[model samples]
Target: MKADTVGQEAADGLLPVLRELCRGAGADGSLPLTPRALHAAREAWGAAALLRLSGIARVLGEVRLSRRAVFHYSNPDCPCCRHKLTPNERAFLSLVRAGIAGQKTAATGAALILTEGGPVEPARNAALALRGVWSAGPV
Candidate 1:
């Protein structure tokens, strides 16, 4: 079978398993898989392929994307310190808040980036800053 076909098959097969894993983890109060965890999952699933193709990795990519969306929707602030938030966290929060405010995610992301003091080299920093501003409130 072609690599793409194999990958699609693998991903389709793995989706239910992955979802079950996530649901079980959530039930146990464990956080969803981190990037590293997702990578590991991809590797484990891809092991079946004699020659791993990029398509085979899409299963993990979808997991990561779903996780990101969940994280963004949750708008989790730093538990230890509210002032501090990760870039991904910020991006997610921006998406959620903007959605709540009836704004589009793309526009919100762009506006957040533009509001930064200058060019945002490490994109994450700009994202975090935008989240801070969007979430900031009266002291």
Candidate 2:
């Protein structure tokens, strides 16, 4: 993940935002993975992370690609997604937001999972659960 010009943390943290952006796609059908979309995402995320998240969501059967190169998530408002996250989840969110925004997680001894886009990718995908937990990390 770090090797992809973006750190693992930000890459993970942006998943929820990416998911939401996809949710916001709504009646539009799909959102193109373009620079315009990247700009619409909070500055805490970058193009690389967005692309990676899009890929991961695609693999997870969450995002769908259309002939026009646009994508949308499977379910925008699943009931299970409304629950609160755990401490580890919060930690990952903090690190992800920090990394994307070019900052650092304030938590001491915060050991977070890292990856280079392999099996660990699924673990990183779970960070998408951090959607509603970003009240402090980043917008």
Candidate 3:
């Protein structure tokens, strides 16, 4: 996991939210997360998560989102490095690929992602945070 990701998860309050995403990814843990129960989740998680997802949609180059709730990652490889993405990475990539983007104005959604409401273990949090950004490979 990346320090920046841990920092962001700590500061932004995205672990449990991400945990929930991982929970939804099912046994395989591969990306293109299409959580079966999104309507119920959106209410509990708020639309901002979707907006954060939109930011994800903007970040990844290959993906297909049928709607704000539906996410599909075409090439679920790390944009920065072609690493075997973790389940947590898959979930974040889903968000990164989910539609409903509005980084510039999705204040409500962004706040939901950062709202103080959960605990994030350092190691686990680091792994989860690492899913979002690119990392360098061994030289």
Best by lDDT: 2
Show where candidate 1 strays beyond 4 Å.
1-83, 105-139
In model 1, what is the error at residue 81, expressed in angstroms? 5.8
lDDT of each: 0.33, 0.38, 0.32
Clashes of 3: 4
What is residue 100's positional error in candidate 3, in angstroms?
17
Over 4 Å off in model 2, which ranges?
1-49, 52-81, 105-108, 112-139
Task: Give the TM-score (vs. native) of candidate 3.
Answer: 0.24
Candidate 3: tens digits of C-alpha lDDT, residues 1-139: 3322332332233333343443455333343434522432354345444544333323321221112233322232245432233333444433422212312223222222322222212222322333343222100
- Cα lDDT for residue 21, model 2? 52
Give candidate 3's whole-model lDDT. 0.32
Error of 3 at 13 (Å): 2.0
In lDDT terms, how accurate is model 1?
A: 0.33
RMSD of each: 17.7, 12.8, 16.0
TM-score rank order? 2, 3, 1
- In terms of lDDT, model 2 sits at 0.38
Candidate 3 at residue 111, lDDT? 25
